[model samples]
Each structure stands twice: as C-alpha cells, then as structure tokens.
Target: MKMSDKKEILNSDKAPEPVGLYPHARRVGNLLFLSGVGPRKRGSKEIPGVTLDHLGNIAAYDIEAQCHSVFENVRHVLEASGSSWDKLVDVTVFLTNMQDDFKTYNEVYARYFKDNQPCRTTVEVNALPTPIAIELKCIAVVDG
Candidate 1:
C-alpha cells in the first residue's frame, strides 16, 4: 500500500508517543512490523530495578524487568496493529547478556507465547540504545 494509503494507529492518550523518527506501529498489507521496544515506561523513565550493575550503583539494568518492558511494548504495538499476542508470526530478541539471561528470558517469553510459538531468533549483542539490556521487535499477521 502507498504510504498515504497505509493506516497508522496512534493511541497518543494511552500509549507512549514515538520518541524517534518512527511510528509506534503501522499496518501494511497483511503484515505488521513493530519497532523495537525499550524498557522505558510510558512517558516516564524506565522502571527501576532494570539495570545490569546492581551492586555498584543500581544502574537501571534488570534483565527480568527489561524482558517484561520489551514484552509490554510489544503488546502495545500489537494492539495498535489490530491484533494481539496470538497473531504474532515472528520475533527478534536483542540482548546484551544472553548467556546470563537466556533461561530466564525463555521462561518469560513462554508466558506471552504459550501456544504455537512464533519463529524467533535471539542474538547477543555488544550493547543497545542507551545501553539497555534487552530489546524486542515483533511481526504479526493482521486480519481484515
């Protein structure tokens, strides 16, 4: 579909506004591509206890919390795409500490995708935006 013809869903009142040069979610044809979601709370600093170096200075880096935040952002994006978690077809997880959080991550990931889990790829990266621990991007099929 043409850019002008494509439909954009913006829940400015309920969802976090786009922070960069992209929309939160957009639907084109039968596919929806959601931007990678960070751990930042809606219109607020990221929830505490989501940092890596906890004992030193409580740097906002908690692997479990980051996973949940990413999931929450994915949920919002899916809802905006006229679908829900069940419609997801693919997912890409980015993390800085894959070795340390792989098991815990899978545990939480399973809750969101309890049946027919979508195709997924997990990659351990050197770092992420703002040096966060995790990021998630989703793709879902949109129903007419």
Candidate 2:
C-alpha cells in the first residue's frame, strides 16, 4: 500500500493516554479502530469505581461507574477521529468478572446507546493492564 494509505494514529487530550505503545485509535480508510479503553481518567492514575490497595490490587469496584467512564473515553477517541457514537459499528467489551458485572454494565450501556445501538460482544478476562474491572474496544465507520 502507498504510504498515504497507511493507518493514521488518533489521539485526544480529553481521553486517557494509552497504557502501552499503541495509540488511542487508528484510522485506516473509512474505519476507525480504537484500542482498549479503561476507566482511568486523563492525566491521572484514578480509576473510577475502583478501589486499589497499596500494592495496586483491586479491593472493590462499582461496575456502573467504570462502565460509564470507559464508554465516555471511547467517545472521546471516536470524536477525535471525527466520528461519533452513532458511527460506531461494533464494540468488544472485556470484564474481569462477567458473571457478576454483565447485568450492570449492560444497563449503563443501554442508556448510552438508546438509539444507535451497535453490535457488541462481552467476554470475561482474568484481568486487564490496570486494576479497573472493565475495558472497551470499538470500531467506527467515518465519512470522508
């Protein structure tokens, strides 16, 4: 592919920095692919709804709060790429305790996507890069 056709990184000061080397999202053609977004706030170590021990182990958490933050962060990345929640086509959700958290997470998710609901998949994972209980990775279709 031509260099101009290569993917472009997307970043937003309103969103938390990536936990690793990857960008917040990448644009390839008309699609924007977002990285996993956690509940940690921008420029801070705070993870909403999560209480961490001295050693950074999760002591307790509120799935509703974390879910809100994660979805808002995803929105920031999407807007940074000139897209919006309505443009989202698919989303992959990761939960540390799916059996216990799915109901609450789904409730919050429904509030956000009341009209433009996208295809979604929720999976249970042992853990994430941070102590937060939830993360979201999404894909959006953007107009040229």
lDDT scores in order:
0.73, 0.90
In model 1, what lDDT does residue 52 have? 40
lDDT of 2 at 64: 94
> Any residue pairs clashing in model 2, and if so which?
none
Residue-level lDDT tens digits of model 1 in 1-144:
665466655442334555678877667767887877766678665553464465543465567777777787778777866888888999999888888889988998888788759999999998776556777777888887
Regions of candidate 2 where Cα sits further than 4 Å from its true position = 1-6
Candidate 2 per-residue C-alpha lDDT over 1-144 given as tens digits, one digit per residue, 9 for 90 to 100: 864486888898999988789999899988899989998999999999988888888889999999999988998999988999999999999999988999999899999999998999999999898888999989999887
Candidate 1 lDDT = 0.73
> TM-score for model 2?
0.94
Clashes of 1: 7
Model 1 bad stretches (over 4 Å)? 1-15, 51-60
